[model samples]
Target: MNKNEDSVKNSEFGFGESNDAYAKYFFGQSYLKRLASNSDEKINVSNVSFEPGCRNNWHEHSIAQILIAVAGEGWYQAEGQVAQKMLPGDVVIVPAHTKHWHGADKDSWFAHLAIMVGDAKTDWYESVDEAEYEKLN
Candidate 1:
């Protein structure tokens, strides 16, 4: 494939190995690569990748969470709100204590860089049921 072809074909392919430690917090397949993060730091960054149809469970942060879409497409939704489609360059700021869930669209792999701030702690709730997620499509 030519460069352009390669890019287009893999637009929905996630990079990196599967992340295991936090797998329990998510649904389907996802991976994590920490870039600049420390337990003592007020802000940390990590790159996360999600397989097609994969997503994290509904959760809330103690302070704030920022998501920067880096590749493919996905969805982000807060409690009681319609799911927002996320594409490259899209940024979502999740304020402290607001319930939200994010992940790849049904046919696309998604990836993003997550900037975590404040206490960087999260409280996870229930998994997003397949039927509920499919509604956003």
Candidate 2:
């Protein structure tokens, strides 16, 4: 397979059907591959890909997170706020315990290097309401 194809295949990890009400119901064009696991480093590191309309539920970390978009376009939305468009080379730092959600836009594929500090906790909350998400588009 080509390098890009390999990358796509490698990005899938731990991600399965979304049980939450707001979880993306259709995989459609979206894709995710987990390139690395917690075994590879002191902290948890994941390579994730989001096809258009794919996104994580609202959540936060006990420790801060640093997201570096390696390819395509995406967006991040914090609780009670709007989402900001992200592009290649964009780096996002989410403070500890900050509620937010992020993923690829409705029309583009997005991938990022997800780095999470160790021993931290992730608190999942409600999905971003569609009305709120629509504002970002």
lDDT of 2 by residue, 17-133 (tens): 322333453233344444555654557676667666667778888889989877667788778766788886799999998998888776666677788766787778766667666
Q: Candidate 2: list runs displaced more than 4 Å.
A: 1-32, 37-41
For model 1, residues 14-124, the per-residue Cα lDDT tens digits are 355677887998888888777776777677887788877889999998888899988878899999998999987899999899999999888777788889867767889
What is the clash count of model 1? 0
Which candidate number has the best TM-score?
1
Q: How many backbone clashes does candidate 2 have?
A: 5
- Compute the lDDT for candidate 2: 0.67
Which pairs in model 1 have colliding backbones? Answer: none
State, as a TM-score between 0 and 1, how close model 1 is to the true structure: 0.86
RMSD per prediction, one decimal? 3.9, 5.4
Every model's TM-score: 0.86, 0.72
